[model samples]
Target: MTALPIHPDQRTPSDTSVPVSESFVSIQGEGKLTGVPSWFLRLAGCNLRCRWCDTPYASWEPESVSRPVDELCEEMRATGLRHAVLTGGEPMIFPQLLPLTERLHRMGVHITIETAGTVTRPGVRCHLMSLSPKLANSTPVGDPRDPSGKWAERHEHRRLNFASLNELIAGSPDRQIKFVVTGPDDLPEIESVLARVDGWKPDDIILMPEGVTVPDPDEVAWVVEACRTRGWRYGDRLHIRLFGDTKGT
Candidate 1:
């Protein structure tokens, strides 16, 4: 996706032209900086199809709407918010996101990226990087039994790639590993990734529940106990509880 051109008058659209699904202002409801005012930019496509995806509107087919980047940036600035969260169907898919984010930085906005931990780029300098590593429970594209079997099968080749995790984490300070636990079955995968990524203290890892609309209190308690045992922290999806997973808060 490419950024949209600015109109000479400079009155731009609310969204960006870089193939956006939606954009608006909301509190950062997840990750390290939860409960912070942040402008949300949801991109239009994703490489992986997790079973419990909450924002299918954006992830399933975001390419259908192409927004101009100038308009999108203007939309963000108008919000009067100091923070911006760049999220996706895999936002890294849009090569132009670098320029979009760079402009945001120039505006003194603190930027955060919520990604699936597969792709990487050097220029999209975000202040906070929330990378959720895909697990086996995350359906690979094209696996028919996957809840969205039809969609997954068609996009299997474009499944999320873990090729950039190393570079992204090398010098990142305001970053965290967020793992969505689906019952007890998901813990092993988290352990495996942690073991591979040495020096990632448990304090830097956040275990969250997998519910889309709302997190179960029981699950949160279980995760908290597990984190206590492992020395990690438990993160709850604040938006899901406060807004029931609806868009635009």
Candidate 2:
């Protein structure tokens, strides 16, 4: 598979065009608002490439239909669901999101923007900002597709942006800081991240296991114990458990 070029800078409203991978209605699978009925709009494109990325189709190649702001709003309105989630390879990279979210809010829809927390848009509005910052574990190794370790270096440099994370946390009315835990080794990294952010309660943090389908039982147990000990929350990939790794959930 061929990976597409990365667009790290924020786009403009006049150039408010978005590449949409897919959109569907599904229960909130992870983070603070789990089990809530919601509509997901998965936008295409991302800057960093994680080793265990689940949505490679949406990120690696990023082949998607160019949808205008009005068309996207129409789809969201047609869903007739009050809860809507704007997810992506990274949604904030597109300036079109600002207007799209504004429309959703006007329709009285509660919006959740899921992101890697490496980018932020001040004008974008979201009821909940689900921030999942990538860690060292995300660095891709020697894969035949990217043997030059380019993705590894890029992922490392661009994975964590404390400025963006802080802004998203402060801007959103409700927020959750989710960290993908691959194993016990990643615990310290999580703590390091927590130390950087101020004014966050234990309940605001969520630890999720890194897996495509259902999380491993052993990993879940360890994460549960860690969450219990730290007074944080444990997140399960509910969509993976319920609908497997298939798209359009």
Model 2 TM-score?
0.91
In order, the Cα lDDT scores of the candidates are 0.72, 0.83
What is the clash count for each candidate, in the order shown? 12, 0
Model 2 misses residue 83 by how many Å? 0.8
Q: Candidate 2 on 1-249: residue-level lDDT in tens?
A: 111122333234543668999988899988878899998999999998888888887777786888787777788788878899999889988777877877677788888999998987866768888889898998887755578888778889999999889877877788888988888899998999888876578998999888887766764798999999999998888888899988887
Best by lDDT: 2
lDDT comparing candidate 1 with the true structure: 0.72
